[model samples]
Target chain A: MSELTGLTLKAALEGLAAKRFSSEEITTAHLAAIDASSALNAYVVGTPEKALEMARASDARRASGQAGPLDGAPLGIKDLFCTEGVESTAGSMILRGFKPAYESTVTSQLWRDGAVMLGKLNMDEFAMGSSNETSAWGPVVNPWRQQGRNADLTPGGSSGGSAAAVAAELCLAATATDTGGSIRQPAAFTGTVGIKPTYGRCSRWGIVAFASSLDQAGPMARSVEDTAILLRSMAGHDPKDSTSIDAEVPDFASFCGRSVKGLRVGIPREYRVDGMPAEIDALWEQGIAWLKDAGCEIVDVTLPHTKYALPAYYIIAPAEASSNLARYDGMRYGLRVEGDNLTDTYEKSRAQGFGAEVKRRILIGTYVLSAGYYDAYYLKALKVRRRIADNFDQAWQTCDALLTPTAPSAAFALGDKSDDPLAMYLNDIFTVTVNLAGLPGMSVPAGLDAQGLPLGLQLIGRNLDEGTLFSLGSALEKAADFRARPAKWW
Target chain B: MAIDAATVRKVAKLARIAEPESRIEPLANELNGIISWIEQLNEVDTDGVEPMTTSVAMGLPMRDDVVTDGGDPAKVLGNAPRAEKSFFVVPKVVE
Candidate 1:
C-alpha cells in the first residue's frame, strides 16, 4: 500500500479498468491518505461524495464497455478551476459564497474521460503568489522535506495545492494551470511531473481567468507518461472556447520511448542567471549529461530577450487579469457587497472579496493601463513580449527543444519571499518566458537538493509540439532516477 | 524607492479598492519597490525590440456580425447585489 503511493496514472488507470483494483478501492485509499495527511493543507475542500459518485460512474462505464483512457483514475483539481455546485473560491475571501452553475471545460472533460475528482486543492488567492502563502485559505506545505532541515516549505504556486496533493499521494494526478509558471513551478517544488501544453491545447472556458492570454490548464502527475496521458484527455478543441485550438489531439502516450537518438536539445544560455543556486546549476548540467548519454546532441542557444520576460509578463498578465477580474464587481458572479449606491456596492464588493495580493495586482494592472501611461507601459511590454517569443522561434530552428531550470532554485520556505512581492515575482523568472512565447513547456523532477527537496528540469517545445516535449521529458525522467515522497505523511 | 501616498490613493480609487490613509503609505512604498524591481528592464537596451502581447501567434478570431449571445439576463443578474425588473439597479448619477 505504501509503494502504491508512487503508482503512476497509467498503472492506476489500467488497474481500475482491468478490475485488478476497483475505483471504489482506489478512491477509498486515496481519501484515507488525504485524511491522514491533512496537515499538508493540500486540499481546500474534500468531496468524498463527489469522488465516490464519480468512481461509481467510472466503474459503471467500464462495466458497460465505455471506459476512456483515464477511466477510474483519481485526480485533484486546483481551486482556481471552477467546479459546478462545489465551492470554487480560487483560494480567496472575496468568493466565499461563490459556486459556478457550469463546470469548467477541463473538469467536465476529466470526468467525461472517466477520472475521479478527489476535491478542490488550495492555491494562491486568484493565483497571484509564487509561494502558496498568499492563499486566503493558507499555505500548502511541501511534502518532501527532511526532518530538521526546515519548517513549512512551499509546494510552489499558484498551483501549490495540486502539486502538494499529488506529491503527498493524496491523488494520483491533479489538474493545474500555468499563466506564469504556476503549474511547472509547483511541480518543481514538489518533485512531480507537470506540463503546460500549448496555449490553446486545453479549453479555458468556465475557468476563472487569471491572465486570459497566458493561462493554460494542464496536468501534474507522478511520471512523464502519466502527465502525457492526462494531457491527451485534457487537450482538444472546444467550440465554447474561441482560443481552443482545432488541431488534432495526438496520442501523447505513444511519444514516450527510450530513444532520443538523434534529437537536438538546446541549452538556452540566458536562462542560467547570476545567483542561481549551485545545486540547480549542477542539476541542469546533469540533465544535459543524461541527454548526451541518451544520444541527443546538446547545443548552446541564446534567447537574447530573456531578461525582459519577467517584467513584460508582470505588466501584460496583470493588465489582462485586471480586465478579466473586472467582471467580479458587485454586478454579477462571485460575492456581492451591499452599499447605499451602485458605485459603493462595486467598491465594497471588490474590496471585501479580493485579498491584499489580488488588489496589488489590480492596482498595478490598472496603473499600467491608465491614461497617459498605457502606451509607455502596457504597449511597451507587449512589444518586448513579442521579441521574447521571436527568440524562442529562432532557437527552435537550431534545436528540436529547449531546456532550462524550471525555477532559479528549489522550493523556498513558506513566507521566505512573501514579504517582498518583487521577490515573489522573480521566482517565476525561468518559467514565465514560455508563457509569453505561448510555447509548450513541462517540468520533470531532475534531482534533489542537499536537503532532499526536488529540483526540476524544464523542457520547452515549439508551439503545439507537446509530443516532442513529452518524449524528451520521459527519456530524461528515466535517466534521472529521482523518486520523492513527503517525509511525515506515511 | 517610494511612490507618493497620493498616487497610491489614486490607484486605489481606480482599482475600486478602499485603502486607508495608514495603509496608503505602505502600499505606495511596496509598489515603488516592485517598480524598482521591474526597473531591471531599463538596464537592458531594447533599442528595436517589439513588445509581445498575446502568446498565441495567430490572430484572435472575430465572430460574424450576428446576434450570437445575450438571452440570460435573469441568470446574469441573479448574483447582482441590487437589481430591478429585468435590469441591475444603480444609484442615480445625475439630477
Candidate 2:
C-alpha cells in the first residue's frame, strides 16, 4: 500500500483513518526497518513487542470510534525521556542501567495521543556536545553519504539518533530535545525538519536535564507538517514543570501552508560569519529569495551580540550541566564502583562512568562555578546571555522572523571534528543563539551541498511564535522541494 | 586564562570526579582551549547589564504547596543500584 515505511506522519495518519492500513501493519513495518538498519546506531533500545501491542490497542480504539490525535503512529523516543520501566540512559555509562518508574510528561502525552513507542533513540551524553560523538554508546552514523565517498559522517547531535532514524525511515518521526541546537543541528545535517519551540513551551518534567534554562523538547520529522502535528501533542503547560508557560497548546498543524504575504523576514548581517562556506551563504540567499517569492519582504537586520552567543552558551550550558549531572553519584541508581570510603566511591564511580568529553565539561563547569571564578566566568556569561536575548528583542522590532543556515556546514566525517572540541562546538554556531535568546527556531532541509549531502535553512521566530516559523518552513519546503532521501545502505 | 594542571585537579576534586595524576596535564590542556575560547565573552561590555535569570519572561508557576507525590518506596528505589528495605546502600562514611 504505497510503501508503508515511506509514508510521512501526515500520510500515515490519513492511511490509518481511511482503513487502508492497520496500526499493527505500520508498526510492524517500522520495527522491521529498525531491525535491519542497525548500522546507523540510531536506537538504544527497540520495543517491538510493546509497539505491536500498542498498535493492536490503537486499532481496537480506532475501531470503536475513539481514536486519539496521534493514534496508531509509531514514533521513536529519545533516550533522555524517562519511559516507565524502560531504560533511560541519556547516552552515558553512568546511567547505563537506570530505569524510571515514571514517564516523562512529553512521552506520556505522546502515548495519551496514541503514538506507539518504537524505541528509545540515542543522544549525546547529557546533551553536552554539538555532535553525537560524545555519546558513550558510540556515534550515530548519518544516513546520508557524500556523493561517492564511503567515509562515515555524523548525524549532528545531541539528538543524533532521532535525526538519523527519521532520515533513514526507521520510524514515522521521533521526539528530540534542543539545548543549543541539539534538535536543529542534527536535523540540518540529516535533511529533516525539526523545531525547538520557545523555552517553557514544553514541560521538562521527566527528561534528563542538561541545561535547565535552555533545554526544551520538540519534534523532528521528514516534513514540517509532521513536526507541527507532533509538536501539538508534545507541548503543553505542565504544572509539573514550574518554568512551563501556562498557555493553551495551539493547533500547530493548522498553521502549515499559511500565507507569508507581507511578512517581513530578517536576514541578520552578523550571521554572515567570515570564512563560512560559499554554498551555505548561497543557500541563505536562496531561502531569502524563496520567501521573497512567497511575498515575504526580506530585510537586513543586525544582531550585534551574535558572535558572543556560542562563547556564552559554552559557559552557561556546562555550568548547569555540571549541577544537573551531580545527581549521578552511583548511589540511587546506575553504575557504582567500590572505593575506600563514601567520598572515594563517589569520585571513583563518576570518574569511571563519565566519558572524556563529559569529564571535560564537568571540570569546566565546576571551575566556572567554583568560588573564585564564578563572577569572572559564569556571571559574566549570564550578562552576555542577556545581551544576546536583547539582540533578538531588537530584531523582532523590524521583522517577523529571521532566516539563517541551520548549521555552518553539511555533515562531516564522524571523526573529522570530534577530536577538536572547539571545532565540534563551532558546528552549533548558527543554532546556539536561538536557545540563548529563548526563541523558536526551525530547520528545514532546503537543498543539498556540493557533496550531495542535504543542507538546511533555519527560521528563527519570536518567543511563543512557532506557528509563523512553521508557515515559513512549509513555504521553503514547497519552494526547494527537498524530497531527496539518503540511499539505503544500512 | 589557561587552566593549569593544578587547577584541573582542584576542579576535578570539587566536581567529585577522580582524575589520575597522569591524566591531569592532558585534561588541563584540553580544558584550557575551551576556557580560553569562552573567555571571549569578556569582550562584551556588560557594566550595568543584569544576568539573565530566566529564559522566558515568566514567573515560576506555583501549585498548592501540598505533597503531590511520594509514599511508594518500591517505586522510589525501583532503579537504585543498591537498595535495602527502601534505603539506598552506600559505602560507610563513618569509620
Candidate 3:
C-alpha cells in the first residue's frame, strides 16, 4: 500500500498545503492502491484519468494560492449519486448503463471544494438490502476477517463499498447515504466513521431515491474528524431539494476536541433487546463509563417505541420506495425489455430489470399501499413512526444526546443472514430509530468483538445538532483509541 | 393477513411488474412472511395518532408558478432507451 493512501483526509490536506507532494502523486498512488484492491470490490468504477485531471487542476490552484479545503484530496462516491457522464447504477441491473447528465448537489459541492473523484463505489441494489449480496455487481468483502479464518466476511451494506474502501485505505473518505443504517451500520462493520446527518441536512436532488423521507447523504472516513471535515463540504441548503433544511452549515471540524463536560448522555433501556451479544453489552458499558469519565451525566432513559421501529421502517421505506421507483418504466433510461404492447413492455422491463431484493421490496411496498390494506399496514406504520419520533422528543427533554451499540453484533460472513430477510432486517435494530426520528447519528469504532472484527458504539444527537455529536464522537474516538487495521488478505 | 398467490399476482400487476405463474407461490409466501412481521404494528394503540408522512414536520415549500430551469430537450432525453429527435419512444399506445 502506498503511504499517501494511508494518510487520513486531514493529514492529506495538510500535506497538499505544505507542497510535500503534488495532488497528482497522491491521486496516482490511490488509483494504484484501488487497482491492487479489486478483490475487495470496493469501487464499481475507477476513474484514474478524471482523478488525475482534477488533481492536476488542484495542484495548479494550490500554486496560485487558491486552494480549497479539500483541494487535491481523492474520495469515493457511492454509486447512488448521479455523477455527470459516469454510469450510476445504484448497484442494480434496473439502472444498467444509465448515466446522469447532471451531477448531484453533494458531489458538485465536493468538486467545488477541489475534491478529486476516484469513481463510484458499489452498494446494495437501490440501497434496499442490509448486506451487499443484493448488489448486481457483487458483494464487497470486508477487509477484516476473523482470526485464523479463510472465509470472507461482508462489509455491511448498502454502503458496504464505501465502508470497505475507507477501511482499506483506497480513499481518504467516501460519500455514503443512510436510509435505515446504510451508512452507520457499514461504518461500524468496517471500523470506519460514518454519520447520517439529520434528514434534510444534505440535499437528495441528484441521488437515486430509495426511501426519500429516510434517505440522507453523509460522509464515511477512517476518523471522526475526517468525517466531520468531509461533511462540512457536503452539507448545505439547496433550493433544488425543497426538503433540504434551510439552515447555516456549521464548521463541523471545529466541534472536535471540545469538552464533553456537563453534557447529559442518555442510555435508553429499551435497546437491551433479546439475544444481544455479551461483547456488545460490555462495549456499551465501556462507552458509558468513558462518557462519565469525561464529566458527562449518564442518565438511563426509555424509548418505549423502540421495538416497533424496525417493522415500521420496513413498511414506510418500501411503501415510499414503490412509489418513487415508478419512473423506471421501459420508455425512459436504463434497461428496457420490449413486449407486444406498452403495458406489457412496462411489466416485462421491470420484472427483468430489478434484482430479487429490489423486486421483493417493491412487492411488499405495493402490498402495503394496496387499496384495502392501506390503512392496516401503511397508515398503521406511519402512526407507529410518529410515536417513535415522539419517544425521541420526550427523551431529548432529559438528555443532550443518546448512546447505543451501532449494531447487535460485529461483521458476519457474506452469506450468513442473506437467506433470511428478517434476520438481515434485524441488523438495523439499534440504528434505525435515529432515521425514524430524523436525528443525526454516528458510529465510532470503540472496540473489537470476540472474533477480532471491530465493534462500534452509536451516538445520536438532536435534530440539526451534528456539532454536538461531533464533539462527543471525537471524545469517544480519543478514549477508545482504536488504531487496529484489518490484516491485508485481499 | 397472509398474502395469497392470487393477491400476489394482482399486486404485481398493480406494481407494473410481471410475475409468472411459477414464481407467484414463492413470491406470495415471501410477501406473507414480511407482511405478517410488520402486522405486529397492530398491537400498538394508535386511535388518535396522526400518521407521520415525513421525518421533518413541515409543509411543502411552495414557489411561484414559473419555469426556473429545464428547457433543453436533448439533455432531458440523453438517457432515454429509445428516442427520436426530441421525444422518448415508447410502445404504441394511440395507434
Task: Return the top candidate by lDDT.
Answer: 3
TM-score of chain A of each: 0.98, 0.99, 0.99
What tens digits encode model 1's per-residue C-alpha lDDT throughout A1-490? Answer: 3545557888887777668887888898888888887788989899999999988888888899989888888889999888888889899887776777778998898888888998999999888888899898889988877546657788999999999888888899999999999999999999899999999999999888999989999999989999889998888888788888889999998998748889999999998888999999999999999999999999999999998889988889889988988888766566777777767777888988888899989988988898877877788788778778888889988999988999988888887888878878988999999998889999999888888788899999988999889889988989998775666643
Q: Model 1, clash count?
A: 10
For each candidate in turn, the TM-score is 0.95, 0.99, 0.99
Q: What is the Å distance of residue A111 in model 3 from its true position? A: 0.3
Q: Which should have the higher TM-score, number 1 or number 3?
A: 3
What is the lDDT for A380 in model 2? Answer: 97
Question: Local distance difference test, per candidate?
Answer: 0.86, 0.92, 0.94
Given the true complex, what DockQ would model 3 score?
Answer: 0.87
**For every candidate, what share of the true interface contacts is present?**
0.61, 0.97, 0.92
Residue A203, model 3, lDDT: 97
Candidate 2 structure quality by residue, lDDT tens digits, A1-490: 1288889999999999999999999999999999898889999989899999999999999999999999999999999999999889999999897889999999999999999999999899888776788888998999999998889999999999999999999999999999999999999999999999999999999999988999999999999999999999999989889889988889999999999999999999999988899999999999999999999999989999999999998888889989999998999888899899988999999999999888888888888999989999999999999999998889889999999999998998888887799988998898999998889999999999989999999999998999999999999999999989999888
Off by over 4 Å in 3: none
**Candidate 3 chain A, which ten residues in sequence have the lowest lDDT sum?**
A327-336
lDDT of 3 by residue, A351-464 (tens): 999988988999999988998889989999999999999999999999999999999989999899998899999999999999888999999999998889999999999999
